[model samples]
Target chain A: MAKIPIQVTVNGQTHQAEVEPRTLLVHFLREDLGLTGTKIGCDTSQCGACVVMMNGSTVKSCTCLAVQADGAEVTTIEGVADQGNLHPIQEAFWDNHGLQCGYCTAGMIMTSVELLQRNPNPTAEQVRAGLEGNLCRCTGYQNIVKSVLAAAERMGG
Target chain B: MFAPEFEYHRANTVAEAIDLLSSNPGAKVMAGGHSLIPLLKLRLARPGVVVDIGGVAEMKGITIADGNIRIGALTTHWEIESSSQVAEANSLLAEAAGGIGDTQVRNRGTIGGNLSHADPASDWGTVLTALNATLEIRGPGGATRTASPTDFIVGPLTTTLGETEILTAVNVPVLAANQRAEYAKMAHPASGYAVVGAAVVVNVDGHTCTGASLAVGGAVPAPVRLTSVENALTGKELTFENIEAATAQADNDLGGEILGDFFASAEYRRAMAAVETKHALFHATEVAHH
Candidate 1:
């Protein structure tokens, strides 16, 4: 198979490369770009461990083809923080104990980034509904909801 | 999770996409890739060439004209879920889109891909059946045609759409002033696919049901219209008892073998068909003699 050329901007960095057509966006981010922050869980698209921001919307990278993301702007979990400064969502997650195993934290924070962007002042129920795509088996999502709420308040929502 | 190797082509226009498909017998059109990619990774679909129409500008949008609403094929579920146009045109579509999958899936999953994939448990088919929506299809040499859900979706993961045909748009009639519509679903916990989904559109004249259209999916091969129940609701008062009596006939119209999996059995789904129908009608006619 011929590798296709795709120019994707990941976290404000543009990289032009030839990738196999079968390469998914998550693989492109983790393997080709060597930005391993995006986790791939339940590669069948059921789990949102591979969730990332593409053109301002969150999508399951495991389900999206790298070729499909040609010329698009992508933001992985690595891009969430600003110059070693934790984003408000990340700080809230930490302060609120949103994670126990830390496996789903990256995806949860990424999803919260989009959710809060969409709804600045979301209720706890709304936060839970918005994060339904991402699953966390250990924490039971009680603190996750609280983290999102706490983040909303921190963002002056 | 890698799909089998295949050639890839990005088409800028629908004509180019059509040419790509017509030129290769083993080619498949991918819009959004949420449905097809999963199938590909599962080895359920193995096309020789994959034509991506994700960036095609001609196949994306939502519009209303002449008392009808037109949603382009590339319209994502998130677009429908958040669009005030869709909400005003048909709140059922917006609500159904909101309930489909999750935020991530809705953000990227295209309506064209969902209709083209035609999963048995997909919510669009049942909601479209209730809306009497028509699917717009285009083939080689500018050939265009339309089909209802029944004619378009023949069975589970099967459709009458030709190999070279591409779904261009979904055309739905705007709900009338007296018409009430709702879609109710029992979504699977893990996958978010409908375990049993029901959609109802009813016309009422001061609490008297004048006409009705209802469909149920997830329990059958494809969305099945409950004509007997539609008849049962006509000229009847909108009451919980009447709704229960009417929806009890859902199983009668559900012909053929019911699809079953570990999450839900055929018997359970068959029985819930009426229950979901009642839920939908109750929602459609909410605050009406409840």
Candidate 2:
């Protein structure tokens, strides 16, 4: 099979690659670009472990194809932190103990980032509804909601 | 499952996407990939070419004009769930959007893809049918056709969409005054797809039901309007006893029509559908009362 040539902007950098048409965005991020921060928990698209921001929206990277993301802006967990500073969501998660095994942290943070950007002051129910797609097995998500609430309060909205 | 190896093409326009599909005998359009990718991986769909239409400029936004709402094929479920316009005009759509799969799925699943995919367990299908929405499709020769939600889906994982045609948009009418709707579902824990779901729309006239539409999903091969239940509810006052009695008709109406999978048995789903219908009706009545 011939590889499809496409351009995608990951985080803040643009990269051109000739990838197999069947190559998923998760594989492209982890293997080709070596941005291994995005974890792949399930290929069946059930788990939110592969969530990444595509054009400012969070989508399952495992389900999306690299070719499908042509010219699309993507932000992964690696992009969440800036210049040695953690994003408020990331910091809140740490302070609130939102993770135990940490497999779902990346996707959770990415999903939370997108949710808060759209909704500055989300209630606990709203946070749960917004993050329902991202699953965490180890933690009960009580702390995750708390972290989001803390971040919302810190953001002053 | 990984998708079978296939050629890839990115179409920037609806016409180009249609042409690509027409030219390729076994080509499938790729939008959000939330639905298609899994099928491809399972080898359930073995297209020779995968047309990436996610970036098609023509199929990308939510437009409201002339008392109608037009949603492009590539509009993600998240966009609909969060769109102030949809929330303001058609709250049922937003509520349905909020109930689909989860955050990741909502962010990537397209309404066009979901409708075209036509999974009976799909949350949006039930709500759209309850709303009497229309699906727009464009074919090889630039011909367009419209199918009501009831006519659009044929069975589980089946639709009226032709191989050489692409779903362009979904057009929905604005809700009328005193009309309210709701979707209720009992979802399978892991897949997040419904085990049984119901969508109810009601038009109230000063605490009396003037009109009612009910549709059942995740219980049959396709979501179907419950005409028997609607008939029972019409002209009836909004009351818990009335709604329960009317919704119980699902047990008789959908007994054999309900689908069975590893997640649930047909008999179980039929029973659950009745409960979901009651819940949906209750919610719809609440909305109408408000």
By TM-score, the best candidate is 1
Worst ten in a row by lDDT for model 1 chain A: A131-140
Which candidate number maximizes DockQ?
1
Give stretches of model 2 more than 4 Å off: B287-290
Task: Summarize candidate 1's per-residue lDDT along A48-126 as a digit string, tens digits.
Answer: 8889999999988999999989899999888988999999999999999999988888999999999999999999999
lDDT of 2 at A18: 94
Lowest summed lDDT across 10 adjacent residues in model 1 chain B is found at: B281-290
Question: In order, what DockQ does each candidate have?
Answer: 0.93, 0.79
Q: How far out, in Å, is residue B233 in model 1?
A: 1.0
lDDT (Cα, tens digit) per residue for candidate 2, span B192-254:
788888888899998789998788888888888888899888999888888878888876666
Residue A5: error of model 1 in Å?
0.6
**Model 1 TM-score on a 0 to 1 scale:** 0.98
- Chain A TM-score (model 2): 0.97
RMSD to the native, candidate 1? 1.3
User: If chain B of candidate 1 is superposed on the true chain B, what is its TM-score?
Assistant: 0.98
Evaluate model 2 with DockQ and give the value. Answer: 0.79
